[model samples]
Target: MAEEELQLEDGSKKKKLFIIIIAVVVLLVGGGAAYYFLMGSDEAVSEEMTEQGADNDSDESLTSTTVKTGTALYVAMPRPFVFNVPGSTRDRIVEIKAQLMIRGSDNEEKAKMHVPLIEGALLRIFSTANADDLATEAGKLAIRESALKEVQIALSEITGQKVVEEVLFTGFVMQ
Candidate 1:
């Protein structure tokens, strides 16, 4: 009977060990998935950057024509962008007032129509900028360029043309 009891104990221990091994494997898989999601794919970002660069390159001639065709127009936002940007140590609040430069009444109207979409994209871009990125002149310039690219991309999708000539900041403050 004692031998039988010892055998049962050993069997229970084997079952527990098997369950522990399965749990560890599950945990490892979950960690890998999380890491993959967080890191995403650099290839995707590179592809987008290449596509936008190509679009901008091809539109250079068209850009000049649009400028010459009509009086330049600037559309200002109803309110400044106010948001918090994450940093290594803490969060910083940033406010930016910007104007969109376009040409002709049609593009102006389209720009006005897509204000919300433009704002959404800008907010996404702005929120992702860390304090380190906002603190330096070069970083700020890069951020501005990124903001312009995002606006142009959004407008291109809506109007089937690059409606924005430039994104000029009227006011910028951070704390």
Candidate 2:
């Protein structure tokens, strides 16, 4: 009876030891899977993000011309240190120093409008600029866009036509 009891006790201890080893192996495999999920996929996610971003960017611009046979005209924008709004007390534009040229079409009608309306449109652009805009790259681009729009409007108003498509900046010097 004593021998049988001792044998049973030994078998129970072996089973418990086996259970402990299995638990340790399970824990190790679970930890390995967690690490793989958290750290191993970072590179793949970054590559996918970069590829998607590239696809979303704008296509390159293709240069083209639409003018029927005729002489092209280029007009210089008025050079100004700064232009003030007629009624506003604060001088919004610190420096308005840039030259924009307008390309003309076959009919001089569209081209001729640039000479007369450019001054007023330029005045509007200068009065729109501020000191900070004259200092930064983003600001400069903003000012360029503002001036371009003004030029386009002036062209449209004068010629009763969509004369200028792009306002070319021939020169720009701001302090």
The number of clashing residue pairs in model 2 is 0
Candidate 1 residue lDDT tens string, 1-175: 9999999999999999999999999999999998887667666788898887667666764332233357789999889999998888898999999898888998899999999988987887887898878989888888888888888778777778878877788998989
* Residue-by-residue lDDT tens digits, candidate 2, 1-175: 9999999999999999999999999999999999999887998899897785565344322111233234456544445445443323333434444454335444344454355476677667767666655567897777677766676666656555445544555555543
Q: 147, model 2: CA deviation in Å?
A: 1.5
Regions of model 1 farther than 4 Å from truth:
1-68
Clashes of each: 0, 0
TM-score of every model?
Answer: 0.60, 0.44
**Model 1, residue 67: displacement in angstroms?**
5.8
True lDDT of residue 12, candidate 2: 97
Candidate 1 residue pairs that clash: none
Off by over 4 Å in 2: 1-73, 78-81, 84-97, 105-114
